[model samples]
Target: MSAALRADPLADDTIAAILAGYGGSQWEAIALVNRLLAQWQSNADVQGWQAPDGTPAPIAAALQAYLAAAATLPAWADAARIERAEELFFDMSMLSCSLLFCASLPECYVVPDLAGVLHVAGQLEAHCDYRVRSTAAMIFPVMMKGGLASPQGGGIAQILKVRLIHATIRHLIVRGNPAQAAGAAVPALDAPCRHLYDTLYNHGWDVPANGLPCNQEELAYTLLTFHYIFLRGLRRLGLGLAPQDEEAYLHAWNVVGHVLGIEDGLLTHDMAQAEASFAALQARGRQSPFLPDPRPALGAALMRAMQDQIPLRLLKPFPVLLTRYLCGDAARIDLALDQRVNLLSRALFGAGMGLARAIDSVVRLALPGFSICRMMTRIVGYQFTVKFLMNQTRPLKLPPALLNQVGHTVRAWGDDPKAPRWMNALEARLAGRKARRAAPGGQPC
Candidate 1:
């Protein structure tokens, strides 16, 4: 990461403007954060927004100004490429969910500095589900149809709120100064902050050592995890996209990075640039060891949470194995997933992977589109969707309307129009869905 990029956090503008507009009052800033939380929780539709109840006019105006500007598409944003990327994501469907849970998220925790911030703000070991769910909350909105382009799509609205949330985290952690760079160093280690809502106040962050919480460098790295790492995972599973498709996917997420207030220089458009940048940033982040070493605990908690979601005993180990497979030795070692799984799970996973690859190689000769690996991964993905995304008891903290939309999307993933009839039936039985829609894609093909 560049020194200038590392020095600046994204909150330097819009959020700063909002807080300053509120007269820089400590009580007012806190109130605004709380108010945003309340308003967002109750409202799913983001096409039109209103000032939250009891919002001071100045603060509300500042927020309105920020959203209006932040929600806009960049001058260079390509609508065609973005729509193509959306199509690719939709076609990938349930398999995308598997990659997200196993690849993108596990790799996210591999960054020491980012994990350190999560440690501070998230009692991650205890609230593992919240970490997973919250990540999905952003992802679902961003990838949903017209999520970024249309006013009706929730992506821009949710991303604007997330951008603010990042700034708010920095504000509270640094005691509203927002200038942690020049601050006196707090002691290196202190009691870990366990507060749920307010990881809100002092968590004894050594800003000189850690940079700012949710700094630009870290945010950019995370965008890579979702786009670059996810694509990389697809390749590892023998499901790589066409070059144009890959570039389109990267483009779509770079747009999201822009929305999240990440610097343009930090975003990469191709896999080669992405790999080099990701490696450089990971190396830079690791050079300064984040104390308390949050990666292992955070990794364990994430794996355990995921494992708990799968009912099939044999499949419980799949999340860890898939994560370790997608992320190589370096990340595997970092996350402490280097340990061996039970002999049976290992043997079965190893054999299953080999069979999938062998079958895919032969099948592709006759039907160039077929991939057993894709089917296998989609089945695993379906399990994650049903357990994590479709759980009625603890539905995503989305407005009722958006939650309904998400549920419909997940259910539709049960049918694959492109797959052979037999494969679709197998997918249905294995995924515990009733059956494919009688006519796939709503036509009698």
Candidate 2:
């Protein structure tokens, strides 16, 4: 057994206490986000078509203050390391996105509670494409240069927004139909194991009216999915990183985990730690009484949507084949992928991938700095983004009504009828604010 497993990690009670301590803060953060959304809406109404600079007066000031407080880099964070990680990330953007969507997402459904929450929330129903697009939108900005720490970048802001959305999910699941939530539950286990089980399988212990929905452990589990899972997927693709670069990537995400309210203990700093943590978590998941519902319909929907992005008909099947390849047969079956590839087709796909990898190897050997893989990633990522954005008449964004129904005040901006009105008003308000500030008074009244 790994030393980590042998160390006798914190008892269930200790973990629970830690979770409880953080739960309140998470709700408070959500409350603040709720207000921010309202403020953004109101500001947009006043400003007209121009995007709000995240500065006006109290609203912008409040958001900036919250970000400033929450966005601190962890004591262990390394600026130079983070820079290298970001470069590596852009260099392999396409593969990263593929792993996230095809591999990581499918793997997520393996966790019964997560699948239950997403299913009950209707996030996987008819609006699956929107949910996927929204998630991508949140992640892309953060991966870009200067994104995580910069107030102007979407990293911190987008993550915080996702955290709020998680809170909203917890609220909805707890308060929604009891039957549905129960259906989502894993089978009962013995008392001693129950707490750990609940932590891993159930969302968390039931709380009083004021208690939060999700717990710290659940949040940490998600952080692992993004950090460990993504890295593992890359390794599987035969894309190796320098040991320092690997650690740096993990370190950068550890900073993100800290900002997202995950405890330091759960944040992984290196590949060894990540592997141990991942194995332990997976073992716990296997103990769940329930099997995940045949991969949420959303998986298939996402695959179909991806097909539209690739121009060549021959490459249309490539996405599904790639997903199947990355996730393996078990995941494909669990996800209920409807398409079937004959042996010949599978062989062809395998050969193509092998040839591509071989070509990439030669290119890397000939010119270490120039990566054909990176070029492919850029082209593929751009095409996918263009198609995803245009999927809806209005540019798609997240925290859709399905997920945010509990917070009635929170609505999907993409589908909002008032979008144009608010947008037009925002331009006027921003212009007026600028003019007033320029006029002798130093600030707009």
Candidate 3:
């Protein structure tokens, strides 16, 4: 094992390797591996799965148990936090697998049971649209209801629309690559992929300018969400990016991040600024329904459940994918992607709220014991490591080297890991310095 994996034994790389060696459904394996980890961590005296010196057994053995438990994981063992964390890991892993795809030729295919894949896609499509529309209904609600309110209520709706556009386009595109992109000899499925990209590129332009009923504060926050989504999607598809396209996307993304009140430091480190800005806007003066701090309550609940003895699942999607997707099966890719969209949507919008309510509910569901602050810390740490340790220690810029690394890692996760890359590569290209030159002046997209 590499020192990186050994030092940070729970590093995404190690976890991914562990998952790959085990044979089980991705989600089931996730649950089992985590459960075993918690068990091992808590008891140094254990053997079998435990090492002779009290450390956990070889990573591969733990992975085997995780896979073995797949057939037997209790139906009643639904830990909400664990499930949520696994879902996020699953999403990141799926993306990583695609980014790491290194084959010069297209991968050959084994036709999967399209029924399960398509069914999941259908359910997710319906779920995402419902959430988007529900949030849409909240815009200018009093006016829509013919009640007493000014025009500004609609601004929240518009911001939500832009976010929904992002969420939808991303999920659709990510779902596209592995199954259809790999197998299709024709363009029928590719049309939706192209359309989704077009939608993201065009619709996102309006978010920063929408005459929402908020001060500069809320507007900046809204813009940041849109911009981050754009950047993130683009960064994932590194190798696929064309030289000409790189600079434009990068410039637009960075400028937008700047305009949305993101300081270079905060953008580089503490990313909660965007979310914080959103909260400030929501709570401009008096209390707003759009704002609440759920961490304390969620933490309390988690403590109660664990009796302060167990480690809950980590919501690190990228690591989990690394473990699961190392083998070259495409079906696993489809399964992971399907689960990711469904889980995010359900967690975000499973509650019956209109679009605005869905947003609020998602925020609520995500934050309960979820620790955005901790997540923010980890994100900053990861970026810093990438910059320094990875010799990417320069100012934020897209590098082909970075892209190549991401592609290889992603392919390790699953079969259809293409959409995230496609979207991300475009974003990365736009993020490149060349794209910046293409524009007469640096401007937000």
Which candidate tops TM-score?
Answer: 1
- Models 1 onward score TM values of 0.91, 0.64, 0.18
C-alpha displacement of 305 in model 2, angstroms? 2.4
Model 1 spans > 4 angstroms off: 1-54, 180-183, 187-194, 197-200, 440-445
Q: Looking at model 2, how many pairs of residues clash?
A: 14
Off by over 4 Å in 3: 1-127, 130-216, 223-256, 259-278, 285-412, 415-445
CA shift of 125, model 2, Å? 3.3
Residue 193, model 1, lDDT? 47
Expressed as tens digits, the lDDT of each residue in 149-264 for candidate 3 is: 11212222222223322223322323221112222222123223233233322221111121111222332433443333322332322222232233333333333333222333
- How many clashing pairs per prediction, in order? 0, 14, 46
Better of 1 and 2 by lDDT: 1
Task: Report the alpha-carbon TM-score of model 1 versus the true structure.
Answer: 0.91
**Candidate 2: minimum summed lDDT over ten consecutive residues — where?**
409-418
The Cα error of candidate 2 at residue 407, in Å, is 30
Residue 219 displacement (Å), model 2 = 2.5
Q: How much is the lDDT of residue 377 in candidate 2?
A: 34
Better candidate number, 1 or 2, judged by TM-score: 1
